[model samples]
Target chain A: MSDLFPEEVRTERLRLECESVADADLGERYASMNETAIEDGELAYVPIEPFEHLQEARDFVAQREDRMESGDAGTYVVRPRDGEDGAGYPAGEAELFAVWDERTAFMTFGLRKRFWGRGYSGERAAALLRLAFERLGVELVSVTHLVGNENSRRAIGKYVDRFDGERVGRFRNQHVIDGEPRDVVRYEVSKADYEASGERPDCEFVEERADGGDGA
Target chain B: MHVGVANLDCLWENRRVHTGVSLYRPYWGRGYAGERARALLSVTFDRLDLDVASVAHFEGNENSKRQMEGWVEDFGGREDAYIRNAVPRDDGDAEPWNLRSYSITAADYRDAGGAPEVELDPENVPEPTSEPTDLDRANDGGDGA
Candidate 1:
């Protein structure tokens, strides 16, 4: 149970590595990507305030480590498998927050501005959903985005639709952004829904891929 | 006179709270649940200055469903989602509950002329006017009634 999620999950185009404070380089990359998101004003759409200093992001990494150790969350750095160009750096972050009592987990992710236009959102989500359903053994995965965030609307919509998730309607005043109440669009994919979807994204655990290293 | 309880739980942020009402079996349908709910909404939107008041009921809890259906729209609320595995059971034997959820924004509350002005009092317990029913539990899931 403690080892429900793997250390690393690989999609065809991205590497989702578990966030670990023991790895100073991974911590640096995580903090650097966060700074980039803050500078790009991407944090405006997210619920959190921008990091005031580099150490804040580093502190956040340490906090996430505590959460992971408590079995309440799994945080991963999203990077391109091929480190060519700037894509090899931490492109974004993917997260799964457990609601263990209900057998459900919340899925959230974000990418730096430079990585936005590409299909990385869906690709990363594919890997995260596989972790939630296949590895974590949760009964349901839920996703919610601030209502006016059109980028997230499109990105979450595409991946959620492909997995046959239900678009639970726009909840009014579901969240507060910048001191103003705002709406949120929620989506959910049950284990049954994922199993029934014909177009689910392909993902493989790194160890599985290495073990089955076949020439076919 | 001591019926049950009403809850206004801070949910996501200060902007929203999840509200629910539960009355003992003897106090089932004298409209105490509705009256308390109306006052709770008044507090939620008017006094608390909160943005939204949300509530939900388990799938098979017809008593709560009827209560919500009766007044949710009159207060300008709407059904938000049917969330699967949303509530855990105290019994610990069966699966988590599938809930039918709803919410009312401050704007919606204002648009519907808001809940009728009612003063909230902690000691204001309603006197039972009807006999306890053996029909069904009004607050089966402890979520709402």
Candidate 2:
């Protein structure tokens, strides 16, 4: 793990573990979840298509681990603390990747279909924003979603507004999704703006997983 | 005379283009930057068919601030954001640049009368003559007005 972030971070209702390739269970579950990510248009806005095979997903997990080891970015597996269905089975993934040259970082996350509509995005966003501003000491933290993703548009809008961030603009052709360029809506919160906005959602850094054991 | 270079950089997966200029100190306030910017806007909207054109200037750069503001006002754009520590320093000791950014969409460009009325005809050229040209006079330190 990068020294910038803890092994685990938590919001009020969610626990995000920094993902690693060494965690065989996580790689297996992550790959399985992504295999059907495109079903029912769940990952339509995401740039990559559904993972055709396990190796593709495993390769992705290894890449994320490499990014963390390089000290440039961190990817985490998000799980619910207390839920009846899919409580702790890699409900989603959240990441805070630094744009080191800009002294900034960007947030990205995606949830499984069963995990949607619960405001978990906002929850993880709070933790990630806290990590970006307080832990990483970055100047700005940004989040972007496809222009047509209404769920993300609402979720990100609500939290970013709460954090006193501004809508940078709707940038065109921001991503190439399945060989077609797509637009993205971007929002940003500078450290000064985030601090001036005062506390909103609270987050905590933890030395161990919420389960008090290693490797989900 | 190789006074400067103008740039239109792509951003957002080639959806938008950001304009910039680097002029020699002696050519700083000659309105050349403005002329180049107008041409770039034509390329951005009229020729390239891009959706947006953006410009940014580091904080405390009055010349760039004025220039960027002029484009925003003339092109019916707005100040989009104030980004802090937006660019890292190469010197290792200096601080990153804070930027004031602005943008104009295609619709806004059209509302602002679209591209300026500047035409180019490089294919039609006049052969050089012995008569002194205005550029030659300017090179000789004359006003060339």
Candidate 3:
């Protein structure tokens, strides 16, 4: 477990943990958000059938974990405090997940419907990015809004320094959203840009599981 | 919303003013592309404080071109330069393609950042710089011509 993570880092707004293969249940739950997210994102970018079931979610999370363990990707979980769902947390509704390569971060909190409309996304993201920049030493992080997800767009907009207008190119073969392909609207942020944004990089959050374990 | 450009690793070698962009066709009418471009322009000029912010596209892809055009007008970008046949469409045969460019100088965007700071209500953030009328515009260009 020690080797699995660099060290336990806590902020007033979130707890950053490293996820492990054992945390398949969290992955499963995250996968559950796919159908809803499809309506919010992928449905607008490209066509993709809503994902249903734990196996698929587990598999995807496994892949992401592999990336993290192998140093190809960096993953972090969002554990919001109880109540105060402003950060998109309805106290045990879902887990916030951020996956990324050196240049991009794909953020999706495995949250429930109850978490929406709260300021959870923005506040939590600020803490996460702070950790990403100070500890992870990442250069740029990117995300996408699957068209019509104005909520995602609005929420995500706060975390990144919007630049270059680019749409998601064909990501593999897509068909879940009615057989149409998609181009997820892409967004990104850089270390330099992050610092430059005049945002407070030192954010606050409580602590939680690092290997993708549910704090609950 | 603000997003970081790639760490000028090899991207920001010079003070070129252009952005690499792609947006969903479904969200095409939303003007987010322009909004984001303007915001980036703000970053380049006000935050990172670079002298010029840029954006690019192929010669014929009007869809992409149109977005860049709005960026030029909205983000304080200038329509002064071009890269000839830099991007070639892949056909049976390869060919040189034009990579059109647009940009906002640091001075241009900093001044732009000062007004009507755009805010995301719940977020309560930066006031967006809305286009000013003749008098406001005169004061905006106050420091120089």
- Give the best candidate by DockQ: 1
Query: Model 1, range A30-142, lDDT digits (tens) per residue?
Result: 45655454565677777666565767767777776676677777777777776435645777778888888798999888787777778888888877788888888889999
Taking all chains together, each candidate's TM-score versus the true structure is 0.83, 0.79, 0.43
Model with the higher lDDT, candidate 1 or 3: 1
For candidate 3, what is the DockQ? 0.02
Off by over 4 Å in 2: A34-37, A82-84, A178-183, A196-202, A208-216, B10-13, B45-49, B90-93, B105-117, B120-145
Predicted candidate 3 versus true structure: per-residue lDDT over B1-145, tens digit per residue: 2221221211232333344544445667676766666555555554444455556677788887787786577546565444432343453134446556555666666565532354324354333333222344443444541
* DockQ per candidate: 0.42, 0.29, 0.02
RMSD of each predicted structure: 6.6, 7.2, 19.0
Clash totals in order: 0, 0, 59
Model 2 lDDT tens row, A1-216: 568777788787888887666664645565556655446887778765667777777877787778778888777878887653666667788888997777889998998878789899998998888888888888889888887899999999999888998887765555777766677778888888889999656888875455443433
| Per-residue error (Å), model 1, residue B99 | 1.4
Please list the residue runs of candidate 3 whose C-alpha ends up more than 4 Å from where it truly belongs after superposition.
Answer: A1-13, A23-54, A83-110, A161-178, A202-216, B1-145
lDDT of each: 0.75, 0.76, 0.48
True contacts kept of each: 0.53, 0.40, 0.00
Rank list by DockQ: 1, 2, 3
Total backbone clashes of model 2?
A: 0
